[model samples]
Target chain A: EDQVTQSPEALRLQEGESSSLNCSYTVSGLRGLFWYRQDPGKGPEFLFTLYSAGEEKEKERLKATLTKKESFLHITAPKPEDSATYLCAVQAYHSGGGADGLTFGKGTHLIIQP
Target chain B: GAGVSQTPSNKVTEKGKYVELRCDPISGHTALYWYRQSLGQGPEFLIYFQGTGAADDSGLPNDRFFAVRPEGSVSTLKIQRTERGDSAVYLCASSLDSNNEQFFGPGTRLTVL
Candidate 1:
């Protein structure tokens, strides 16, 4: 079965602290890996999409990197506003026009204390 | 451009009642998706619609949960005999295409009492 797991279910970091969140997956055929940031009572906001190993993407203070079996989201000098649940999802390649539904991890609840 | 939108930001209903959650995708988006997120858990896939057709409904939990996108832009998720277990946030997303990045809505919080 295809599954995605994120480590450090919860993390508390001080303002200006830099850290990384991990997402590991075991899927039949990996099509893409996605990163999202979700605030409480809101839907997830898209961050990045990594399609292959060694791929990297960045926006603002957040960066996402991908490997064969895992992906990492690195936050540089995170601020209190950046605090939210970071989610990782995978798209599996199937015979039926590529499955669009994403299998998401439980997500990492991040708190940046000021 | 405006992102996806969902109606009834919060819905509190009694068990055994029926409810409908609506989603309006971005203009020109051909693919729309529905997901459910329970407390402390990630969003789980529920259904996907490509244009006017439902490309995938395998993620739907059971027959009681149904979705429709008759016009390919606006969609509705209907639930019958709602149970307490059905209490969760219903999220709607849309993409230009099935394989592209999806834009999500604010989500509708459904609470079954």
Candidate 2:
């Protein structure tokens, strides 16, 4: 069974404190892994996409790295504005038909205190 | 310049009523999708459309849920005889292509009473 699981469902970080979120997935064939930040009452905002193991991408204060079975999102010197639900999703290669939608994990709710 | 957009930011309706949620994708985006998100959960795929055709509808859950994208740019998700279980935040997203990163809309929060 293909599944995506994220650990540490919730996390609290003081301003300037750094942390990392974990996302592990099991799938027949890996296609792409994506990270998104979502705020309450709004939609998810795109963050990064990792295509292969050992690949990494960074934006602003966030960095995402991928391995064979898991991915990590590292937050550096976070601020209150950086507090949001971080979502991780995987798209399987050759998902039965030509169409494939992302399989998402529950997500990690991060709160940054000032 | 504009991102994806969904209409009726919040909808509250009684069970058994029919509802229509609309989505307008980004200009020139050929791939559009619909997803449902319950409270505290990630978005789940409902349907996918590519250039006016439904490439996949396997995730529609049941016959009561249907989506259409006639022109490939604007799409609508229709729910018939809705139930309280149908309550969720319906999200719409579009990508430059099928394998690209998708941009999401603000989403429509549906509350069935």
Model number with the top DockQ: 1
Interface RMSD of each: 0.9, 1.0
**After superposing candidate 1, which stretches have Cα over 4 Å from the reference?**
none
How well does candidate 2 reproduce the true complex, by DockQ? 0.82
Where does candidate 1 chain B have its weakest 10-residue lDDT segment?
Answer: B94-103
For candidate 1, lDDT tens digit of each residue in B3-110?
899999999999999999999999999989999999999999999899999988989999999999998889999999999999999999998888898889999999
In candidate 2 chain A, what residue range of length 10 has the lowest lDDT sum?
A: A92-101
Return the DockQ of model 1.
0.84
* Candidate 2 lDDT over residue span B9-66, tens digit each: 9999999999999999999999999999999999999998989999889789999999
lDDT of 2 at B1: 94
What DockQ do you compute for every candidate structure?
0.84, 0.82
Encode model 2's per-residue lDDT on A2-85: one tens digit a residue: 689997899999999999999999987777999999999999999999999999999999999999999999999999999999
Error of 2 at A6 (Å): 0.8
